[model samples]
Target: MMLWITIKVALRSLWANRMRSILAMLGIIIGVGAVIFVLSLVAAAKADMMGRITAMGTNLLVVSPGQRGTGGVMSGTQQNLTADDAEALLAKIPQIRDLAPVVRGNVQAKRLAKNSRTSLMGTTVTYFPIRSFEVEKGRLFNDADCDAMSRVAVIGATTATNLFGTEEPCNQVIKLNSINFRVIGVLKSKGDQGWFNPDDQVLVPYTVAMKQIVGVDHLNEIDIRANNEADLDTIMDRATKLLRKRHHLQEDQDNDFSIRNQAEMLKTADSMNQVLALLAGGIASISLLVGGIGIMNIMLVTVTERTREIGVRKAIGAKNGDILRQFLIEAVVMSGSGGAIGVLSGFVLAAILSRVTSLQASVSLFSVALGLGFSMGVGVFFGFYPASRAARLDPIEALRYE
Candidate 1:
């Protein structure tokens, strides 16, 4: 019966001051809505990033010449990773399944009068299998192609479209660096991964790229596929030991060659994603705290305006608990109602964001519940002092107030 009465009083008071009640809830609504929208978008984007990385294969490892940080910063000076390192690693590390030395350059491609710039990659025949890429049309290079340093090329799907239109690219000659190379194959699309689009590239045998095109014997990076993911640690250990021996480095010396496994990439990405989520959540929580302060302010004003009411109720057999309960209930109703409204609004905003922005959004039920629970807790926490103040007012003083 007391609960029912308290609820009735809360509803009656809010209905009487509809505008002020709405104003009080406005902060909570915005805060919760922002929490939901931002978190969903970030979660979705992280999941998408992980998915693309996983598709590149789990047992894969990237061996780069210098250390790369999270923000595209390089830790060490660029060391020359050469084809000899690839050959040595393949021969020396029995646990290693396959390897490809990747040499990259930007070149202008011309087919007839049309011209478009594309990223050119020099890689060996083993690169396709190691990277899990399949040829959509024609075939990959054979040993002869690599041995003879043939002027043959394999273009990615997007590169093919830009340089050849809808026409078949197989056996067609395209000019790169003033040399005509026959397109022997076209790679199936891999879309975009991180900073680069795999589909926006043209590939050729590493030897051809080194001798005929780029004229550099050094490699940019090396792609390695371990025999299995379980053997990755052993493989990394052996590879590191071999490279250090080859480069003649001491044990404590910083490595000239850096190895990154697929798992590390995913873990790094996940850590960054988690940090971003926390930052976003922290920023959004500030708005809720501000809204809680607003609730406290409004409740104090309410206590002042309703001084006579408090006195009358106290005189009419209402206990101090009753007065406190009424005000607390009112604050909770304001925040709870606002939280509900915010959740609905957030869903709409998240949907719109997914359609309009590149950020992928996946809404978690945990986040929604957490937002509402947080709002309710904030209401109680901020409302307590004001409710207690109203309850402790002297009946005589309250009743005599002008």
Candidate 2:
């Protein structure tokens, strides 16, 4: 009953100075809202990134011909990997489920008046299943196509749009670097994947791309899939040993090839995403501190203005602890109210941003809880000194004050 009376008193005092209370809350409102807005967008971006990484395959290991070397001087990848190396690895290692020898270059693809510049990827049929690509129209090329060095291609969704517009791309012949290639399939849209876009390219048999187009005799990379995800590490080790022996490297020679696992990509993405979220949250938290200081200053002024009231209550048998409790409760009420309002505003602002921009933003229960808890914490920390000072005042001196 006494606690309820104290709460009622706090509310009445706040209502009496409504304008001052709102001004005091402005800083906290901005702080909490910013925390919500920035964190939600960060969360969304992280989800999108993880999805892209997963799409590349968590069971994958890519073998490349170069490792950037001492000073990272790379005119291009070393011309070390070849189709024979890929074939030897596949035959020797039963752990290998699928493999594709890949080479890539940029080319201008033209059809009539429409011209689109895109990266051209050259690999076997296994590249589709390994990379989780689906054929939306027509079919992916087969072993015969690679053997015959067929000038057949698969186009990504973005590339499909660029070259064919609304018309179907299947069975259409487009010119790549002035060389005619038939588009046998159009891949389902995978959207943009930031650093590497799967939906902005053309794919043809490595044989065709090497013999006639880019005129390269060596493989740029080999994308390998293990028979089981558990076999990834073992297969990587075995493949390394086999490649070293094939190239006749002695014990002193460094590896001319490098292997990359999907797990490393996932770990890197997670750490970078965490760092970004923390940075954004730290910047927004500054406003909460500023608002806390504002609350402390205003509470100090309130204690001074209510000096006579404190003296009257003390004279009427109020204890020092009682006096402290009343002032503290009043400050908490103000902050807690502001916190609730701020959370609502954050939701509204986040929704607006999601609608108006390409940014994907989402609000989570954790962010709301964090903001509210932080605001209440600010109230208690800053409201303490003023409440203690008011409690310590001598009743007689407070009563005599004009």
Candidate 3:
């Protein structure tokens, strides 16, 4: 009953100066909203990254040529990886289930009246299963085509649409860099992984790409698939040893190639995202602190304005604890209401961002709870001093004032 009375008094006091209470709450509204918005966006981005990583395939490893140096002066990448190196790893490493030597180039593709400039990936038939790609239409080129250096190409879904429009691209002849090639297959859509759109490139046999398209015998990268997740590290070590032996590196020499595991890369990406999220959240939280200070300033002014009312209540035999509770409850109500409004605004903002941009925003219950809890905590921390000061006033002195 006493709690209800205190709350009623608090509400009545706030209602008396409606404009002042609203102004005080504005800071909290913006602060909480900003925090929720930034955190939600970060969470969405992290989720998207993880999804793309999972789609790449399990127990996967990638090999790329390392940088070359001449007398302590660093040069560009060493073009040393070749199709022969890929064959060597497959033959020597028992842990490797499959491997694909990849070479790539940028070329202009034309068919009929349409033309599109895109990347050309030269890989073998084993590339599809190793990278979790599927042939949606027609058939993928076989090992025979790769061995024979056939000028057959498989187009990505976006590439198909770009070069052929609504026309069926399968079995159609598309000219790549003025070299006529038959499109034997169209790949299913894989969407975009950050800036790299898997659906925007064309795939061809590595032999053909090296001989006619890219005109280089060296491979750009190698994709390796382990028999199981547990064998990934073993495969990496075996591949490194085999490559070292094949490349004729001395005992004291550094590796001329780099091996990267998909799981480790995903973990590193997640860690970086976490750091970004914390930094963004931390910067936004400064506004919450500012909001807390605003609450303290307003509560101080409120205490001064209601000094005569405090004296009247004390004259009626109200205890210091009762005076403190009333003022503290008023502060809490202001901030709590502001937090509710902020939470709603945050959700709306998140929805707007999802609709307007490529960014995916998802609001979790944890964020909402944290925002509200922080706002109330701010009210309690900043409201105490003013409440205590009001309670400490001398009843005689307060009543004597006009």
Candidate 4:
């Protein structure tokens, strides 16, 4: 009966001050909306990053000249990787299914009246499988081509279009650094990656790149793909040892090479997503706190205006718990309503975000539940003191108030 009376009183009070009640709830709405929007956006970005990483290949590993660290691709000063390292890895790491040592450079290409600039990459034919590349129209370089140091090239989709226009590029001759080469193949389309376009590349045999283009014996990186994902650790260990021995490194010396797997990439992406979500949640919590203060302030004003009603009820045998419950419930109702509105608003905001940005936006149900729960908790925490003070008022003094 007491609980029922509290509910009734709370509903009636809010109904009597509809505009003020709405005003109090708006703070919570904004807070919850912000939390949901920020979290969903961050989650989308993490998902995209993970997808791109995985799309490269399931059993793939990246080997660079130096150890991975905080600074990124330029983190390590060592540049010790070479074609020999790739050959040794292939010969020794039995679990390795395929490997490619890559040498990269920037160059200009022209065919007849067409001219365009693109990146030149040198690698073995196995790079197609190790990097999960599919040929769109023409064939990739074979082992014979790599051995002969052939003056032949394969073009990416974007590179083909940019240089040849509507012309069928296969069997055509293109000039690279004023040297003539036959375009024997074109890579199939791969969409724009956030950082670079694979379709904007021109591929030649690693030997050609070393002898004709960059004129360097060293490689930019080595790409490896294991026979199975379970073999990743074993293959990585074998490759690292082989490289260290070739370089004649002391046992106490740190490794001058780095090997990266899919797991590390996924973990790093998850950490970034978590940190972004936490920061957004912190900012949203502040808004909820401010909303709670609004509830408390309004409730105090309510207590002052209803002092005579409280005195009459207390004199008629109403208990302090009843009055306290009434005020508390009112605060909760306001905040709860605000939370619902905020969640709906957040979904709308997420949709808008997706349309505007490249990031994928997904509305998670947990965010809704979390937001609503937070809002109600805020109401209870801030409303308690004000509710208790109203309940503790002296009946004689309340009755005598003018």
State the displacement of the C-alpha of residue 21, model 2, in Å, after optimal TM-score superposition: 3.5
* Model 3 lDDT-worst window of ten: 280-289
Tens digit per residue, CA lDDT, model 4, 1-402: 866766676777777888988887778989999988888888888888788778888898888877545545655546678888888888888899988999999878988877888999999898987776888777889989999999899999999999988889998999988889899999988667655789999999999988998888888889999999899999888888888899899998778878888898788778878988889978898888888888888878888888988888889987899778877887787777788889989999999989988778988988888998998898788889888988999999988877
Q: Once model 2 is optimally superposed onto the true structure by TM-score, how far is the C-alpha of residue 317 displaced, in angstroms?
A: 4.8
Instruction: State each model's CA lDDT, in order.
Output: 0.86, 0.88, 0.88, 0.86
Q: By TM-score, how accurate is candidate 2?
A: 0.81
Query: How does candidate 4 score on lDDT?
Result: 0.86
- Which residue pairs collide in model 3, if any? none
Specify the poorest-scoring 10-residue window by lDDT in model 1: 68-77
Clash counts for all predictions: 0, 0, 0, 1
Q: 95-200 in candidate 1: lDDT tens per residue? A: 8899998988888899998798999999998888887789999999877899998989999999999998999999999999889999999999986765688898
Give TM-scores for every candidate, taking all chains together and pairing residue i with residue i.
0.82, 0.81, 0.82, 0.78
Which should have the higher TM-score, number 1 or number 4? Answer: 1
For candidate 1, the clash count comes to 0
- Per-residue lDDT of model 3, residues 230-298, tens digit only: 999899888899999999999999999999998788888888888988886786578777888888899
